[model samples]
Target chain A: MASNVSTKNTNNSNKNGSSSNSVISKLKNTFGLQQLIILIVLFLIYGLFAALSPAFRSGSTLTSIFDASYYVGFLALGVTFVIITAGIDLSIGTSMMCAAITGGVVYNQLHAPLWVALLVILAMATAVGCLNGFLVAKLKLPSFIATLGTMMITRGLSSILSNVQTETFPLRGTSDGWYKSIFRTSGDFPTGAIVLIGVAILCAIILNKTRTGRYIFAIGSNREATRLSGVNVVRSEAMAYIIAGFCAGLAGIAYAATYTTIMPGSGAGFEMDGIAAVVVGGTSLAGGVGSILGTLIGTFIMTVLKVGLPYLNLQPHYQIFITGFVVILAVYADIYRNRKKNQ
Target chain B: MKKKILFGTIFAALLLLVGCSGGNSSSSSKSSGGNSKNIEVVAKGFQHDFWKAVQSGAKQAAKEQGVTMNFVGPKDETAIAEQLEMLNNAVNKKPGAIALAALDTKAEIDAIKTAQEKGIPIIGFDSGVPNAPKGAVKATASTDNYKAGGIAAQHAYDAIKARIDSSATPPRIGIVSQEVNSLSISQRTGGFIDKMVQLLEANPKIGKGKVAVTGHDKFKNKVNASSAKAIIELRVPADVTDAAGKTEASALLKKNDTICVYGSNEFGAKAIINADDSVGGRIGNTEGKVVAVGFDSGKLQINAIKSDKFLGSVTQNPIKIGYEAVSLAVKAAKGQKVKNIDTGVKWYNKDNVDSKEIKPLLYQ
Candidate 1:
């Protein structure tokens, strides 16, 4: 096993050495083929929608897309770390709901400040992530069941917390109020895109540069092996969750800002889209081998598909079939590619 | 674990601080007796412009009445259970009065009764709890949805009669509704079916009385129902007939020859309009082209109607309903007797589409 690990490391270094200068290296270094696919898909979707509906290419439309993308994007980014470790966090969607409602209840209904509301969101999300990590890393619970339970609990709590309704911030006009431009897009581009870009850059830095990031990849590659090598498996897993929760909190805030209302049921069934983006963008669900760049492009592609399909006069029901097909195709491709890598 | 809990608690505290600060800066200075007594209007989700229009009307009435109004609803339109829970919470606050768009007709009775017991009158808007004890709230102000459906059928028959020769094959019609249980939706569909049946009986010609009203009734009648058989055998009237049930019926119409498709709600209408590009075949001598009419205002429905994919639809005065509901609620809450207010529905077509009467109610 040690020899195999050493050989795999040597091959990774050797491959990195061979294609160090080409544009291909730059693309691979950033996001790789998945990013390219995402870009192509986004453009194709834009063109198709633009042709079908004249309003599709308008600045407002683009802004709306950016607005829609912000929360989902943040959720995707947070989960990217968790995914890279071959773990899934199904709780992000409900966790987002809990955070948003907690913030809304604290800030809006209770008349709290913006910072306090935001802190509550982040703190709630982080804590949930920690709990998720505890079950998975320490108690040895399967990631699926742990997160699923958390998802159900969080969803119930969100509904309980807000009592099921879109809670308005009650801050119609305040100078310090972040409503006007909290993670906003300006001019032709939404500020959400800028935030997405910022997050992408930060995630890239973390995945590519940080020790914790490296440890995440190592753990993803082989958990037991990393543990045998004297790494704190529990700590690394917990960190991944903490990061995931923080991203969810950020997403909750961005969602509240963009939509201007936090509905407990707002982020329903959105986690699958994040997982789909990551997987479609070349992140293997098997863990250890994924890129934030790929995930961004994947998200872009999914978003495009979501927005563009309806404009083509396709029934909304058909989207379910399309999404299901894409998910199956992605998982199959991942398994195939991972098998090839092993051989 | 303790450290995580401590961090979570501290973070929660910080959130409280941020929330408090944001709230403090936004406090209103102009009381004007509006903020003195808060009036809560609980709506069913605001996905469509209908609820927003209702809120606006309610707000206008509230402002005139010197009351502060707050609007709230679940995100998903169909989540009635959530709305019920919200009503309970609102009752605890002891607001001046509660105006609601009940998600569930029967489940809300208990809550409405509780509000009544507390002297917090619950006036329903858009949707009502018909059996909310006695004087649970003075009266309901909403569109006569059933008559609206009948009105749609009348328009469809008029259009068909004017266009088609009576000597030719009688054009068969189909109806689709969004939900089997939605009282308003079902009533509208029933009205349409009733009108269509009347037309068929009077003429003794359309489909020789074989035009099956395949919706809730058909499903209920079925013994060990096969969805496939239902899909294949059910004859819908048009591609996108609004009010709901339009999508499923539209898809079924494509497979079968349906001349006129009727959707019972906005979702049903959207389903038909959405299937416009891919639809084919004729029901009887209608050229395999099923003339569709929809309910509510959706981007797809608007575009389709503009492009002639659908003929037109019945328009409900949702804003007026909203305005009247709030006005009535406020009056009743203040110990004044207010009778049931009727915000009528009207037939809308391309000719009068831009008119003020039809414009406000259209789903854009």
Candidate 2:
């Protein structure tokens, strides 16, 4: 509202005040209005939970909140790119588990080092992402159908590759336990939060300050206009999927670190959680408008609610019920914002 | 351009067929070739490690009996319709005998009735079909969940008795259950409460009405939490996600008066262990700590026992359940008198966790 008002004033008044208004608009553009709103909602929810349950205010609960966020955060980050391009990737859930379990296989059966196994997990998911890209972008299949097929494929593939067994990761104090420390040290430091934030910053740069980023936005807003403007829409669109795939890979690692047991048939409903976080963060499912900042705050909001609800001794069902309301309200807010922008 | 589109459609259709066929063939490949009798075994779909261990035992039994065994289940445990479809398909296959672990027996009445009409011997394993058509389930190979829960309580009571007796205020014993909807889980949870209440009542300091049973409505007694000599709190997460489970477990661990905590199953056990990581050194039999007793065995639970964070755990013999179900099915197929099998449970701590007797039962 402030930016809109200042712009009108600048057009009506003299040139002297235009410079300051322009700087203010630029500052507002960097953080944006919707993101700031969601950020406030995140804090408000935290304060409410804290007020209701003293245990929710403890440091350990904060760690628990972070523990829940790592994988979902990475997942929301990756899918943000795909959602921005107006395409959905349903396979990220199963594909993430498929890649993680395969990485466990590589570590256990092949005796690969931990770092090598992590790389294999990332590569495996990216490969699936590439396949999703090929089907949706090149073959002209709808993104939904393409990802749905891959979702079932990866679910079956994870079971087959691991022989329907639960793959075990290293425990704390083992030689390769250092990998678990990527998410948290044994002393209870949540290093994974730092890693999640750093990655978010990098993704923000790629989406905002890069050529592929502009193409993704342009393709989402007007595909025909982008093609007419001689942009390589196919390659740019494919990069979004690749990024999503890579993020799912990162999520796979985070999941293994936090839970330490990656079972077959895991990751079935996980895509919904990531997609929910993205939409709640003010990213329009209709596409062409989103921010990594919104997604980061969105992930925390979901996690804090999940982790904090237990403090009130509320059952998991109630938490799910409340989260359903939250998602609907966030989407409604998005619609309301869009309507106002148009008017 | 039209011809190319036709070619593309055919190519994609072929690929889809190939993909489906590839998945189908692998699952079907488990049964043996040749003239051997085939036995179809359907177990619970969720919890891969437990089911896989059972399958391993079934495979060994199939080899010993010279019969081909095919095991299958629905993707989720609560998928009643999907489980019914699988049961129907198993009956339709006309195998010599069928072994079923029904998630809901009434929902599977039609398929169970079909198997009985066809004179196929039906054996139950795990939480076998209870209250099925008169004699539809000829025998069940399962660990008595009530007895199993009693075993977990007996062991846990021994370690926490002194603390309960000595505390000025009523000491708290916490039970973390994954959920109370399932029969086996409810029985185990109920049995634990009954057994613990018995033990506390037996003590002179805490008589019958002095002990409070609180939490979910299914298990709550009339005794109030604050006025009681001892509190037995039962917590069940609304769902089965690890995060929810962890939160439930952590809540129990966080209470100051909590002297002992017990997790009902592998999921509960693993949740307690994960919750312990965030809380740090709080789950042990020491001063200002909690003693955690777990049911079932997973690597994390096993590690907890070895490290002395847990008092020990009660392990259900999944392998025996699998082996016995297949063995009984073979006998019944040959028209021999077959009775229900009771695959029992055992209590193992750090000392015997890796013992030869117990090691095979722990699937990681």
Candidate 3:
């Protein structure tokens, strides 16, 4: 499986070298042309919105964009790994909300310290992810079905735990509200943006520089061949889901910080945004190809469109339609680029 | 193949267990006695404290009236199809009467017709189906949402009239409506916009200058906009989420000329408060403070009003709406003439929020 992927990469690079001898084309080939094109599209959307609405260019609007992207960014980053492993984690959205709601219950109902509740959020989400991994890897359940069941379960659990009440975290001025500053400061600075970038850098390292990452790519490329090579394919596959779960945990914390009120059943559609971001970032749903940096860029593109649509005198509904088109375009670009390489 | 079969069996058993547990938990009450009349009350949803209050009110009425009240609702307001299914199930039971808070007025018309065909009476609450077929709906119990909105507009106008008269440019008042799809919300937003415009035009000082009502195509089409001394800007979020509400509110609150803002529901009110907290915008009639008014009461909104974070709010009597709905249903069940009941609304502020008259109506 490893040799197969390496050979394909070489073939694509050779195709690029033969197709275009220009220095610019070589630069594009070196950097990955698909990622470059996506980056250009992201900037074009941002620049267009800025040009259309003066308010879109302000510092505060930039802060709002960053605030909106943190939770989705973490989800996208984690799910990118699962997608690359030829798997899906539909539970991340609800699991993130449920984790946050559990943290709220611990803080408000059990009188736990704020720090303890934060740890509880991370632990709970990771635990859910481990469950997802166990179902998919150990039991041989499909990732889609396992995560879908987990999604409904977590969503119901959240509603039951919170008792259908909106769980509000402490506001910034309150004594226990200092934790909010982890994502955003009282002065409205986008501290979460820095945290997201740092997390992305770490994920990029894991995906590029580690044995587990290589094994994951190998398993996705050819699971049977990877097992034949005497690799623990089950453990490697499970690790991908565990990584997604950890990211979901972090996403829970980010969501709690950005929108202090956590309502049960409200996070149902959020996972789609994360999945869309991963796909738009050039991560193939078929697996074995993705990057955390590309996911980050994709997250910004989505956030920009969400925050900018209202400023251009367009209603929020238009954002969904335009985003749908952009996702289709990004995936089409991916398929088109791959077809070119094959030819 | 053996492992797959084992997994499938376990999964099936787990699903069965979950299904049984869900059925047991959701069935709140069994039929009390053979002689007791059964009345089913289908609410919008149990997503908020408001619906819980409504359920309690219905239960209280049931206990007093010596009837069996089975209260059920969908998980959230967006589940209209689920609600319709529940309504159909209620009809199948042949209840003496059904009290409904219809999520979609049009969607319920057929169900109402079916209930009528089955000789079951339907009583509407919270939101009434204005266009229901004749005799399909016996009566309705609800607050006059339009008047409630006018109350909000009245208080807001009183606070900002001086500023409106004195500002060199047109002063803006923003309304953050949760959605336009719901009859209650649309009426509330429209009520406020129309009343605010009416007050502006009625005042000699403001009427001398033009009055413009803009933003939100639904409300914009209803009012005339000209070069005016006052502008009422209405904003409705694409969806009913805290993030969307906050975004819409923040956009309106950020305007330099915005002197007042009104959130038309609990979510909308919280959104306004959240935006104010983010931007450090004060909420009161004092100089430089943007007066904030809200509709509906929640713990957050109540605290905000108490802390002077809001000018005041217009609150509906949800408990009364529930009680009246069941009462009307029972009356219709008895073959008596039942008329639409106004559950009423009141404007509460920091000074009167704890008053006896206002305290009972305030839900968590």
Local accuracy by lDDT, each model = 0.66, 0.80, 0.78
Q: Roughly what TM-score does model 1 have, to 2 decimal places? A: 0.50
Stretches off by above 4 angstroms in model 2 are A1-31, B1-364
Question: Could you tell me which 10 consecutive residues in candidate 3 chain B have the lowest summed lDDT?
Answer: B27-36
TM-score of chain A of 1: 0.86
Per-residue lDDT of B59 in model 3:
82
Stretches > 4 Å off in candidate 3: A1-31, A341-343, B1-364
For model 3, the TM-score of its B chain against the native B chain is 0.81
| Candidate 1 structure quality by residue, lDDT tens digits, B141-232 | 88888788888888777766544443344344656566656577778777777776666546534333334444444433222223211111
Q: TM-scores, in order shown?
A: 0.50, 0.50, 0.50
**In candidate 3, what are the lDDT values of residues B109-174, reduced to their tens digit?**
545766788688889888866777798888999999999899999999999888877877778889
Which one wins by lDDT: 1 or 2? 2
